[model samples]
Target: MDFYLVFTIFIFAGALIGSGLSFYVEYTKLEALESYFSENKVVCDNKRFWGRNTHIDRFYRMLLISQLLAMPKTHIKRGDVTEAELAAIPLSLKRWALWPINFGFIWFASIIIWNVWYR
Candidate 1:
């Protein structure tokens, strides 16, 4: 098999695994996260905009919360997240929620780079 083909397969597999992990997190941990940030306006707005108790909404909610947790300082400065709320989030939850999203982002960027380099 061609090296490019093998590389593409590897990337595709990683993306799939990341997506699966995201799905798992959405179903298993999203509700706990929602309760944790229930008082935050940004999270409330996201729930309202995305609607509640649906897969797509869950996915977006997970992404939003993950972003908020990832950059507490930025979100706090923007008044989207309070320091107390950010501090309340568990470190383990942060790791579980962040890894898949981060992986997906890096994989996507690498795919772009690969395409550019080969084309």
Candidate 2:
């Protein structure tokens, strides 16, 4: 019974994290949209969400920041992306939109395996 309880707890926590990530991705997309308008000077900065620093901003920025930090430091190339440009690809462009899907599967599989086999 206790093992089942623990398994359920883990699954619930994982699901919560996954849902939060989904929200973060949406927030990132909104921020990206804000940037696009800002570039054209069509939307004032005040109209953007929390001045583009919403609480969900960190992880979304992580994707861009990490990619920039991973690039080479040398040899100038005309088409090569600069650190700032690389750090601004917009989360809406990433294929990781389905990241939380894995969490749901893992949660279900954990419950099934633990309850049916371990318990």
Candidate 3:
């Protein structure tokens, strides 16, 4: 096998592992929040899940979700998001954003690095 092929495979594997670990961590937080919300009888406003603006800014949503999980009080103070949005973050949109985006970023970065350093 060619060295570059092997190196590329290794880089891809590392990127996949990193993405999996990252998603796993995020899923855990989502689950924890779900449990907490359930236990506390916190009712999320489901209507606001899609958000206030008609425009769907996925990047902003992702950042808002992270902020919601990491700094709930502070993020909530902004008053643009709701618990439903936080909870919905792990659903379809999130899966789309996390895996593909991370993989693409890593793949491109690795290819660029390889070209610059090896080629």
Q: Number of clashes in model 2? A: 0
Judged by whole-model lDDT over C-alpha atoms, candidate 3 comes out at 0.53
lDDT of 3 at 89: 51
Q: Give the top-scoring candidate (lDDT).
A: 1
Ranking by lDDT: 1, 3, 2
Which residue pairs in candidate 1 have backbone atoms (N, alpha carbon, C) closer than 3 angstroms, thus clashing? none
Sliding window of 10 residues with minimal summed lDDT for model 3: 39-48
Better of 1 and 2 by TM-score: 1
Candidate 2 lowest-lDDT run of ten: 40-49
Evaluated with TM-score, which candidate comes out highest?
1
In model 1, the worst 10-residue window by lDDT is 86-95
Those runs of model 1 whose alpha carbons end farther than 4 Å from true positions after fitting are none
lDDT of 3 by residue, 2-119 (tens): 9888987888787777667555544444444334334222223322363443334323434344444556566557664456656655465445435544565677788788788675
Which sections of candidate 3 miss by over 4 Å?
Answer: 31-47, 50-62, 65-108, 115-119
Please provide TM-scores, in order, for all candidate models, with all chains considered together.
Answer: 0.90, 0.38, 0.36
Q: Which runs in model 2 stand beyond 4 Å of their true positions?
A: 30-95, 114-119
